[model samples]
Target: MINKIRLAIRNDLEASAETRQFGSGWISGFLALVASIAGLLLLLSQRYPQWFSMKELALIHNQTIFSFVIQSILVIAFLLALINLVLRRNKILGFSAITLVFASLLIGQLIDPQEQYIANAYALGFDWFVLNLLLTGLLFIPLEKLFGRLTDQPLFRSEWREDLFYFLISSVLVQIISFLSLSPSMFILETTGSWSGFRLLVAEQPLVLQVLEIMLLTDFVQYWFHRLFHEIPFLWRFHAVHHSAQKMDWLAGSRMHIVEIVGLRGLTIIPMFVLGFNQQALSIYILLVYLNATFVHANLRFNVEWLKPFIVTPRFHHWHHGIEKEAINVNYSIHFPWLDKLFGTYYMPPHQWPKGYGIGGHPVPNGYWKQFLYPFQKKKKTK
Candidate 1:
């Protein structure tokens, strides 16, 4: 049994390794394997919601049929890929693929699925989790393929699993983060978002102006917090987890220390509380931040040339991640580059990109838990 577990882990490692080179055949096989596992696990997730998050499942349209179709298509794809891999004598991948099927079957039998859906307020919706994974993969995977700036960077880049763990944790604990981040502020401020005076002022402004005001106010607060993370040695340890991604991609941004996430978000929203932005305006800003942050971290090369000065683009942010000494401590603005320019920290080189990414000498330990605990670990004493 021990040997079998070892073999399974070994094959998965081999399959993961092979995915980095990403040959057409390997890509198809890998996709098939992933689809199968995702599909089956999703099916089983209904029976065992505790195994993974499904909080958003209730929100999906035509949940049951949609799931069945997703699973069926993926299972078919997996079988085809399995046949292809087996014929080609790709044992490691074949082993991994087959293992997923068996494990899914075993788990399905073990769990007694409910006769009807029981809505638990706090249940992790596996359906939601699976759908989120599928949507992001489908959306960004294609974009990275067709328009990547770092063209040679593979779908399965180094430390992908580590970052993936971070992604999963953040997504699963999303509500928790919201509660935690907002709770302290809510407690202290106790300012009902209805400051009638500020609300009237906000109402008087054009909708566009309200949005611009919130963006400006929020970005101003975030800029200083972002800079604090960089400038303070203690905070740098936490922020460095984000910079540890040697390769930048859509998933890279999710690799944040929980402290940084909670602290930054908690603090950023203070202005919102004080200024009393309308619910609609706040919602718009949240939506914009969600998409913009992801786009800035993505592998795609496309950045609007004209907007580089006024807005934050992938190029604008990638330079911030650059390992180059000159680029370090530069480009601290999250939304507008003009803040960086205003602060005298802006350092964009004309007609050039960073030679590489990540901290120069400080290498972060790979994996979620290690990095999470790293900020608190004592520094090694060198005699």
Candidate 2:
């Protein structure tokens, strides 16, 4: 009831504008507003029920009533705090941000009943989705603004919508992606059901050692996979979609070929399975993989000076994506730059960055759907 009344009063906040000013302040407020709306919609999708079906939820199963109540309180508190920020800073929205949130919640509630729903498992995790979005937005937006390589680049650049679509689609299809990535492991387990004893050696090692070993092994195993995508003519067609992103940012890494994701992830996990790391180590590696992948592709101008000789960084990976003829086939390793150096594929220069990016002559199409269908279409002279 309180939410309904608030939305009614806040409807005026949505005044359409023919034009509006844009600046750091506007960007900050927009981020906060979007995050608030995302968090609220996720909350309502559950509290109201019927918003998400039972089968759609994949993260936590059998959510308790207390858990649901606590979650709702946290989301509401977070939204209220955004209003507090606005008032304290005299932001564009003032208390209107909170009212808009309330309005959204009210409309969402009206679409269904208010009765709470709980489940043991398979509950749609719109909650975690919103949290992840807010956390990444808060963390990376500042990093990019302060240290981004392309200082003059607008936050909203060319292909931004395409990358955003890729990010959202990947998030929504995470479950399917996970299952497909596990296909190789499942196949190996099925074929060699009796050889499970080998994994014990890996499992017996200390957890830290296990993680270290997996890291090195993946760098070695996946190196060839990365290189193969470049050397193989047919495969390069699919991988080109990833490099097609002319602009680089935290979100840029998510623009990947669906086939590339399934194949590459599936192949990379084989080492973990064959070597047999414990569940904890495997989970940590997965988290690190995600963070590192995003970080290396980010637009931030981070200088890892002395560490350049050891591991991959934004400078290292960006070179790989450079359109320069000399760097067209270099820097294939994802984790250790040393692997590239040893194999003779490493390409870097003294305090220099790529002047351009993307395929030199081949122009890829726009939009996520178009790019997805691009590899199948025959194009003359793919280089």
Q: Report the number of the highest-lDDT candidate.
A: 1
Candidate 1 residues 21-45, lDDT tens each?
4443555556667666676757666
Clashes of 2: 8
Total backbone collisions for each predicted model? 6, 8
Model 1's alpha-carbon lDDT is 0.73
Per-model root-mean-square deviation over C-alphas: 4.0, 6.2
The lDDT of each candidate is: 0.73, 0.71
TM-score of 1: 0.82
Give the Å error, residue 281, model 2.
Answer: 0.8
